[model samples]
Target chain A: MKAEVVVIGSGISGLTAAALLAKKGKRVVILEQNRRPGGALKRFTRRGIPFDIGFHYSGGMGKGEILRALWKYIGVWPRLAVLPFPEEGNENLRIMDSGKVVRAFFSYDRLEDELQRVFPGEKQGIYAYLNKIREISNTIPFFNLDLPLTPYLHDLFSPKGMSLAQLLMSLIRDTDLHAVLSTPVFLYGVPPREVNLTIHASVAHPLYSGVYAIDGGGQAIVDAFLATLAEAGVDILTGQKVESVLIRGNQVAGVKTSEKEIYASHVIYTGHPTSLLDLVPGEIFRKAFCNRMRNLINTDSMFIVFGAIDDPDTLGDLTWINYYNIRTGLDIMDLDLRHPEKSIMINAPGRRDSDSTGASGGVLLIRMSVWDEVARFDQGVREKRSAAYRKWKAESADKMIEQAGRLWGDAYSRIEPLAIGTPLTFRDKLGLPMGATYGVRHSMNQFSPGVRTRLPGLWLSGQGTLMAGIMGASLAGMVTVGEIEGLEPLWYEVRQCR
Target chain B: MISDEQVYQQVTQIMAEEFELEPESLQPDATLYEDLGLDSLDAVDMVVALEKAFGMKMTDEEAVRSVRTLADLFDLVCRLKNRQVTKE
Candidate 1:
């Protein structure tokens, strides 16, 4: 089979690129290893209860916002049913800091008011802290679109150039206030010490605008994108794993999948960039690039516990807003991989329809787990592990439940079959290398070339290449296709979309 | 006024690309819709491509509507370029 472009991985990045290219009259074929599409946006049902794997919630879906504009350009906006988080009360975040949990509201005045009550003496410092992030978020070229791209590159070196930790220290003297403002780092999967201030601000600023959950869950967004792809006549092949990228001389000739050899001039690999070396021509990819992809240190993986509550009111002090039950003095930079009670994120997911069992469901994400802990279980092989692995999985689920009970002051009443996702699960299921969340951590000090590669037609897209999350993946898709098509016209087109 | 020779070269190349046409098939008097199968989507995409290529906004609705044939498009582009030059 032959196509103009063969895109591997049916994640948001690959799907978006395929859709846009098809619209431009390119015959595109999308290959996904899993039976379903929507990579991170993929959601599955367990005992008739739907649980989202990567998608929890999103920011910037409000009218005329950057995320909204992007979705509109992708043709998924009109059908998307988005609901905002609490307008008051829990605000957006309840960050657990050292010796105390910091409460922050979405409103600037309210957040400032809450912080001022805690640190009355540091009023101006809080104001400066909030203003700086807002400035950094607004200045990003991708968000504004109309702004020239050159200024964004200079941001890492300009006055804004500094690790989030340094900036927070230089501005806010109080450690408690430092912890509160930098809580968004948890979402970025990076500690303040390593995260660039620019990246931290982009992830945080959207929170203040408002965080939103889709009415029908992430499945709705996936369906909408699928509909768009179908209408554009893009061929989507599922359960087809691309074995290797066929390269002749210096350019990508096609891809050999489990099913057949699909020929294409251009192959866009949206899977883990580190895994690309095994697939592509090594000589053409060069030594330095391959070495970097090989030697790159991935961020820590997560241990998630999906549990069901019989009633919503039964969830004491747990509003729809997510909470970070952080144990203060614990260095986020170096988390104790096991014993998740050290630093755990209790995500208060949106209420889904109770199954026949009649119970609401929520997730508890402990971002501490490491791959080495689970590597002992026969590698690359899943579900066929010994009784010891199964026993370990059960004990870990109970441990998370015990942690949650300590926080909520009540043993989970009528807990559902606790579904636990570990690093091994990420590696075996999601195709992440070390089950690394956000593959290849991007820092301001390092240079990660996005989309473009040394190979003529083989390109890279997805969260690993650029930023992480839905917006990052979507924008990465836009940038990759923009490179193929003219960036100027398409970039401006997205700007004028709303 | 911009030279007709310069306008023809630019117009032919731009139209050939935007409409996905062979340069040999493009005639001065050929209608965009009839000759190139240009539809509504093509018009919007063509307008964006032209605006980016010239680095000028296609703000005048009357000028956009007036162009029918390839020759009309060439004249329209020449007028717009001349207007920009006069303004500068």
Candidate 2:
């Protein structure tokens, strides 16, 4: 069926664009490759307990905060089940050298007081650092996914003037606090030095503002978007992977999937833009843009292990823990595969869940650093290598189980049906180029793709776009929607919602 | 010097306090999960709390791969602290 808009991939970006368009009374159809919606923002059931595969915790849930504001306008906030991280000992930063644990609480006053207690003389530095982050976060355009892109920063003193790493370094003297402040760097899985200060501000500024995890797991967020689209009368087809974007003359006519062909006026892809290149070549659009796509460096994918335990309360209530074993500083370009012991961040959602069922029923999340492709494994013989891969996965799971068992005592044995996702899994299942979790890494020289591409009526939105996380993807969606509808009028309506 | 049961008693108390398990219910050979029900996150917290209570520390990596039973944790603490006493 022909529709005004077709959103490929029911991830955050696709959901945002589709829901917004549908809300605006546009005929929209969303195509999701998975049987379920919510691409990376997903949840799975293990041992009858729902565990969030993606979106362990999120920032910016306070009343007027950027992400919360955007989500509230979209009717997502009201239905979302959100629980804040603990007031104290919420964000702990560990120094590998002294074994000193510095905790950053949700309360700004408490965080400041704790910093003073830990580093008596560094109070001034801490104040300046927090202020700089707050200021920088507020100035960046599309910070809330509602701002215009017109004012491309020529003003050097503006919030967009400095990179995130630069602003952070300017504020702190101690090396560990800087690393701790950038602890969330692993969330995007990029080095702190590479992350734009504006991105840091947008993420961190909201947390003191407030952070929350959806109680029903990541699926609730996806379901909310689905409900919004349904209410708007948008058709959604799951398990329909789009094979190609059918271009007619100079315009995007429609898309073809494994089972069916669907026609639409515009196709907005939520996956990596380059993935679309094979289906709809750059030669079809602009040759220069194709070269740009080929040249762009995709962000590193991750290896996540989800474990279900009966008693989650055994572990202290810490929403998330960013563990770095690296003794030195932070650098994205210096990610070394040979060095596996650097830092491994673990997020225990069961501890974070305010409405957790019981100590025996809570879930623990494991995220460790991994290179995109294990150099030894060959993807060409994947089908035949399934047995070998299973062996390796079991070996890997055993190591994790052994390590985890040390912590949980006998509760480690209770953890069953372990699911391991590698970069190859993302490549094979999600159709990501090189299994990149976030689209393209935003580099100093390289400009990540915008919502609009060179191909007329063809757009790119999602983790790969200029912005990387959920907030970033949603912003890209707004930008794409803005391009279709006049920006000023779009802002007028969105602002009115606030 | 504390007796073997006394050492076990102190260890169990810390484990119970940190992991929210009952001290009386915990046994020296009881697996944290198989018997008393402690998970990885709890294990890490227990190790940290043990260090805080005993004034010695265990790395997260060490806390994970090395820990198994309640007695295994007690041994680690004793070794890290250099308590040169044999188990009963």
Candidate 3:
């Protein structure tokens, strides 16, 4: 089959690129290796019950934000049911050890006011510190304008540029407050010290401002993309994996799969270019370009646990992001996600979803960062690794349940039917490099390759291409679309959508 | 209208409610996670309730590790009250 464009991988990036390119009037074909689309965002049923795989909670859905803007432009905004996150300082964090428990709440103003109250001596300093964070976060690219470069440079000069842990340490001399402020970094699936301020600011601000989750599972988001794609006249093929990017006379000729070869004048790769790097003959790519691609770091992998409890409505709320500092240690990245220091965070969607069937009860979504080998656990001894991973998830679940029990007591027992996946699942299923959830880490000085590759008509997209999560992928998609179809037209389309 | 005992009792009640424990079970020596089994999220929720109940602000540092026992939290209530007293 011949097409004007072929998009490999139907993940968020692939879908976004395909939909936008097709909107530009290009005949597009999308190839997904999975029988079901949505990649990590895909959902599966447990005993006829539907559960979202990687699509959990997100922030920045406020009016006119990047996420809201992208979804509205793509026409997916109408389909989602937006639920407000717990107000700042209303977020619940429960820490349990043995039989003892500690609870914490976070609201930005409340957090600031509380800090002043605690350290009356540093009242002015505390407000100044918090206000600085608020101000800097507001100035970030996605928050205000599309000047990704502005936030990037601001973070480079700011305290956050050093490292989240170091920045917090300098701001708050108090150890406990440092822990409190730094605890939320768990959501990014990385420890504070390893996470750069640029990445943290990008994630933390929107959340600090507001957070939201898509209604009827995240797959509806995929459905929305499909809706837009269909309207734009794009052809999508699921369950097809591209074997090679056919090149002729130093250009992308087409893509060859096992069953057939599809021709396209322009090829936009949503999957890892490294996956096809081996497939592309050496003579085609400039040595320098190949070197740059080879050196780019793939993000880390993660473990996800999703379940339906007997009383889902009674569990963690939609915006309930929790963290447990199992041990008093400075080495955040070294902490194993599979075996933790006794702290775990879990969220239940039933509490805040006033629109749910109530019978849908509570939806338990648990996430953790794991080693990348998780995706390759099925080949020979690798199969044995699956058992280890299942055990790890069970242990993690028990820890989560224990923490929840402290907060919800007997109500926690109602949680049941948990499904688990490790980084291996992401690697094998979604074609991620290391089962990494956030693409490559967006560090202070880390130079991310633009969507366009040296190979003409070949471009990159997705979290790995930019960063991870929905907003990042959408922005990456927009940039890729602009590059291919011309930025002015892309912006014009955006204006029209508005 | 709120007495010291009332504030103390309410603080204890927040712990009990958040941890799903009885007020009597929450002793001053009870460590949050080790004895009462509360995770970090519960700590955050407890702090929020405390803020509303006492009308006194609590910092993230104080909330994260300060309230280890029933007495530790009771003392926080006292501090919050002290602020009201000083203000008055």
Candidate 1 chain A: worst-modelled 10 consecutive residues by lDDT: A151-160
Candidate 2 local lDDT, A314-336, one digit each (tens): 54443454323333445532455
Docking class of 3: incorrect
**Model 3 regions more than 4 Å off:** A86-90, A94-107, A114-129, A137-139, A146-161, A286-292, A313-333, A336-340, A350-355, A365-367, A372-396, A399-410, A444-446, A492-498, B1-88
In Å, residue A410's CA in model 2 sits off its true spot by 8.5
Candidate 1 runs further than 4 Å off? A89-99, A150-160, A316-319, A337-340, A350-358, A411-414, B1-88
| Tens-digit per-residue lDDT, A1-498, candidate 3 | 999999887888888888777766789998877788787777677655566666666777877677777667777678677766555424444323332222344446666666566556766556655666677666665666544442343223211245777777666675445555665555555567766666676666666666676665577778888888888878888778778888877678889886789999888777665565775776655443455456555556655566566754455443354434333333433435455344444655433344556555445534455564343445632244556766766776666665556655556655664576666666666666666666565543234455665567777777655655766677777767777787655654564443
**What tens digits encode model 1's per-residue C-alpha lDDT throughout A394-431?**
78777766766676557453345457888888887888
Clashes counted in candidate 3 amount to 60
Estimate every model's Cα lDDT from 0 to 1.
0.72, 0.65, 0.63
User: By TM-score, who's the top model here?
Assistant: 1
CA displacement after TM-score superposition, residue B67 of candidate 1 (Å): 51
Per-model TM values vs. the true structure:
0.80, 0.76, 0.73
Q: Residue A361, candidate 2: how far off, in angstroms?
A: 3.8
- How do the candidates rank by TM-score, highest first? 1, 2, 3
